[model samples]
Target: MNKRVLRIYFLISIVGLLAVYFFWPKYEKLPILETVSSFQLENVHGGTYSLNNEKIKLVTFFYTHCPDICPMTMMDLMKLQAQLQKEGIFGNKVELVAISLDPENDTPKVIKRYSEGFSADPLGWKWLRGSEGDTKEIANSLKMQYQKLEGDFFSHSTTMFLLDDENNIRALYDMAISDNPIDTTKILEDISILIEGY
Candidate 1:
């Protein structure tokens, strides 16, 4: 009887310690990251997209003419959308915004066609394009810098941003590129965290 009682005590202690370790106050105390407000962007097919408009939005900047990084970036976001749809909360609860840096080439027609190509049913997706100066200001505000390269090629980040309804940048991610690939499961997990109270 004493041995059984001691074993029970040990098991309870182990469980308690695990609970403490996993759900520590210190872990909970880590502050939420701040986000930026009020930005504007244009999508690959050409449409107006504004940030911080009272929704949980995922925004990314890319140019259609991009030979390498842009395609990989879009694939990552599309994959993310698929994962979120499986969860059944991404489209209605979150906004997916894509902005294009190559305004000259990425017109509204192009964006529409692009969306069709990207997904048969592109739910909660907004492709944006605007005046070059306006787009520049928005991109600069987000600390995303880009410049036109020679020919039709451009260099830009494959990273995406999460913005709150109030125009704050809540989270950022490097979507899959040929050189670097992030874990899709982990990316979905992080996005789920920002989706709270949205």
Candidate 2:
């Protein structure tokens, strides 16, 4: 081919690639990981709360006595909560749930205190505890594993789940990373995608 023709073709190819890169869908619909069955647990404030809902939810399993991962996760979530609240979607479109793994000891009162310590507003953040059997049932369904250690301590999964409005698990986030526990930026994007029906 002539040099001029080759140069023109290369320029066209570069422009096309740039167009695709810039105009392609950045955030596609998040895949549904699993559909969680509805389960009711005692809310920290008072009445029972069910997982089946129309609002986007971020759910994590933790115990009040957790020395490291649980509290750290809550702190990370607190940051997210502030951002969501600032955006005015904290309770309306998105909500957070922290279910107690040590249900026996994490009573309503204890969970309430824990929630307050993190400044977890009940309107947007729910602290839930149920019977041992119920807790295991829901945790197993969500694939969250936990085992009691000693003296109110327990080893548990450090994963948090993001669920769509239809109760489908959309994404899982790691809370065990020492340097970067939760990717709140990605999470906020995912939540926005879900809210916007993308």
Candidate 3:
């Protein structure tokens, strides 16, 4: 081809590529790490709670007494829940589960009190506690770590995991760390996309 013709074709190709990149509808697909199917625990009401594949779930580990991250994480999720509710996607499409890492100290009553302090909607969110061994196993399966500290204190990672309707781990949010605040908006945007898929 002539140089002029080749240059024209290259320009057209670049425009086409830019159009596709800019105008295409992008749906983010989160990879499935593993299926979470087996877990039984006690809810804040002291009722039996089980994890299954029925609903898209947001799971996080926290202890009622966590000095900072735990409360901040849940409060952030509280805002997320409110946003989802405003969009009418809170309960029918998604649910949130906050599991107590210090189950020995975070009894059903303490879980209830802590959740209420955050104004958590119990109908849409659940606070859970179980035996220390069972809770550790559950955390292990989710790849979250927590260690006992001095005098009813604990050190734990701050992570929130998103599970699909089939109970597959789809995404995770590091809600908080030692020095940074959690990005709840991005997490909610991702959850909105997932809910849209359902």
| Backbone clashes in model 2 | 0
Q: Which stretches of model 3 miss by more than 4 angstroms?
A: 1-28
lDDT of 3 by residue, 1-198 (tens): 999999999999999999998889765577678877578888886567777737778998888778888877777788888987897867777888888888777878778888888888876787888888998889888888889999999988777888987788888888766667678677777776677673
Clashes of 1: 15
Most lDDT-accurate candidate: 2
Model 2 TM: 0.85
- Over 31-66, each residue of candidate 2 has an lDDT whose tens digit, in order, gives 888999988999989898987769999999999888
Tell me the alpha-carbon RMSD of every candidate: 5.3, 4.3, 4.4
lDDT against true structure, model 1: 0.70
Given candidate 3, what's the lDDT at residue 65?
Answer: 77
Q: Could you estimate the TM-score for every candidate?
A: 0.74, 0.85, 0.81
Q: TM-score ranking from best to worst?
A: 2, 3, 1
> Positional deviation of 12 in candidate 1, in angstroms?
22
Task: Show the colliding residue pairs in model 2.
Answer: none
Candidate 1 wrong stretches, greater than 4 Å:
1-34, 40-48, 120-122
Lowest-scoring 10 consecutive residues by lDDT in candidate 3? 45-54
Q: In terms of TM-score, which candidate is stronger, 2 or 3? A: 2
Write down the TM-score for model 1. 0.74
C-alpha root-mean-square deviation, candidate 1: 5.3
Tens digits of per-residue lDDT, candidate 1, 1-198, equal 699999999999999999998787543221345656576565444344556457677777877777667667677667777877778866577767777787888877876787666782445777788888877877787788788888877777666777655656666777667877656676566566655543
